[model samples]
Target: MSIPTTAFLALALQSQAAAPAPAVAPGTIAVEVAEDASAFDRLFTDAVTRALSDARFVPLPLESHSRYIARVTVTRTESGAVTAKAKEPPAMAALGQVFVPLPSGKSQIRGLVSTDLSVDILLRGGDTPVWSGRASTVQVEGSAADAPAAVATKLASALMRQFPRRDPVSVP
Candidate 1:
């Protein structure tokens, strides 16, 4: 190539390398928290949707444009960690059922109820994932009634720690 063309190409390549990667703009996302009872509870879809909205991810109807898409799955389980070793008469069964005791003689049980949540952000009509994250938490079973909302709040907050985008990508 001529000297001028070579220099111009070199500068262009340098700038391209130095430029920061593009990120998903703060815009609407067609979020779908499936009501998959077999995978989790029925309330998870609503909880996740609400949490994403609270995090400022505009929840657009599924019929919107070629924007972003967010799919999340949340689960809460009776980890059965803190059960009593001897099944004789269930001493402190309430606490035992809620908190799994340590396997050591001092306490031999599981630890606590565990909640796990995961999220996937994808570009519309694409098989590749733009961003994804997973978070888990353990809490006493006393709040079982509110566990749905509580876990949702925690998972959503954790996923949104980076918010909008967990990783950067160049838009087409």
Candidate 2:
């Protein structure tokens, strides 16, 4: 450990083994679907383009990331209940013990359906938000078309857990 600190520690370990390995910003990622949304918005854009291409992030096809945009809106709520009366015959009284007439109960009817999906994701630089959000799910057994691929796999696992992992290189 003398010759100029061993040649500066072998040139800082050969520049940390010839750097270059922190590039998770592939490019392109646009998706817009809201034209009278339905059909599970193409299965939630094919499960968020296969979970952002399996986390490799690179799905810009909507005219080439329109313009650094990321918007996803999906609202769903379905309810059901049918039994509008199944027996009716009760409208009298009964006192001093005598006066029958009571049998009219059994009716249930509930309904409420809603579906809205508006997603527009296009990012190629500028106005950086890379991942907007808006997901809701509530179905009481109605329209079970994979429920938009389970809400696009929970919004692509919450935008891949807020993507931001690429910083570990310091050897000088």
Candidate 3:
């Protein structure tokens, strides 16, 4: 899926900021799966679950036995006003240009709201997170594809950079 370039940058930033992982095996994790009530929801859930599994933490079923619990999910939200790009001339283009309107009036593109995708991973339900990351940019409303899975993959990779930790202590 085509995501904003900034999303990849977020992946890098998160990798550096997160504490190192603990000495956990690939199959010792218990994943808290989200309920799928609709096709879209199912897609998102499946993507998240699949990505988590790909990270090789060995996610256990909700009722299965595991040492720790993890919750993975992605959310999209829009906010803030759009701004003009640099290097563009003024709204009038020229200082002496009369800002006259046509019979139908002229329309100029202004700032657009930002669309951000937040990917989070929680272990044992606490204020601190086992993994977390987000990717955001001024995505055109209809120009982007609905690919929660791709976003999850990026988030997972970033979080798993230090997988199978060499240290026994979990970084805070």
Candidate 4:
């Protein structure tokens, strides 16, 4: 209504429109695969790369070009048991009747396999680390053949969930 009030309102609206959006950190996340890592380890690294890419984080070039690094490791253990009964010996003619213990009807086979996967994400600038954390997952699968991949996928999903969403703010 009043001229001074109308002017103030217009100024307020302009200020709100001109306010800058929040700052987003620039740079990329680098992935480093250990040279001694097995084929499965490399696969895990690729899975991690895919997860980070899906999350919109830039994957930097090889270690030569980028400072940030992500490392992954995979380990597996398996145990199993087998039961076999001794065969009965042939009857001997010279000696009296030879007796042998009858085969036991109860027999069992059991096995256990475990896998441990560790993922480390490091956000770095030059030689200094801005953010760093490690995530690991363990899975036990039965005698199924496709269990390894399933376990790795589950582990990768867990790692992705643990990844931090927001970059650390730089303090002035």
TM-score of each: 0.56, 0.28, 0.44, 0.50
Q: Candidate 3 versus the native: TM-score?
A: 0.44
Candidates 1 and 2 compared: the better one by TM-score is 1
Better of 3 and 4 by TM-score: 4
Q: Candidate 2, residues 1-172: lDDT per residue as tens digits?
A: 6999999999999999998544346354665556786776667766766665665656666666343444555555554554344435667688778997776666556444444443434345555443443434333333343345665676555554445442221111
Q: What is the per-residue lDDT of model 4 for residues 124-166, given as tens digits with 9 covering 90 to 100?
A: 5444334333344333235333365565666666656555543
**Candidate 2, which ten residues in sequence have the lowest lDDT sum?**
163-172
Candidate 4 root-mean-square deviation in Å = 12.8
Scored by TM-score, the top model is: 1
Candidate 1 lDDT over residue span 32-143, tens digit each = 6444454345455556666667776777877788377877666667766555354333334247459544434443454567777777778888766676766777765654
lDDT of 3 by residue, 70-113 (tens): 55444456544443343333454334765743243433444343
Better of 2 and 3 by TM-score: 3
Off by over 4 Å in 3: 1-25, 36-38, 80-138, 145-172
Candidate 1 error regions (>4 Å): 1-22, 35-42, 77-80, 83-111, 142-146, 164-172
Model 4 worst lDDT window (10 residues): 163-172
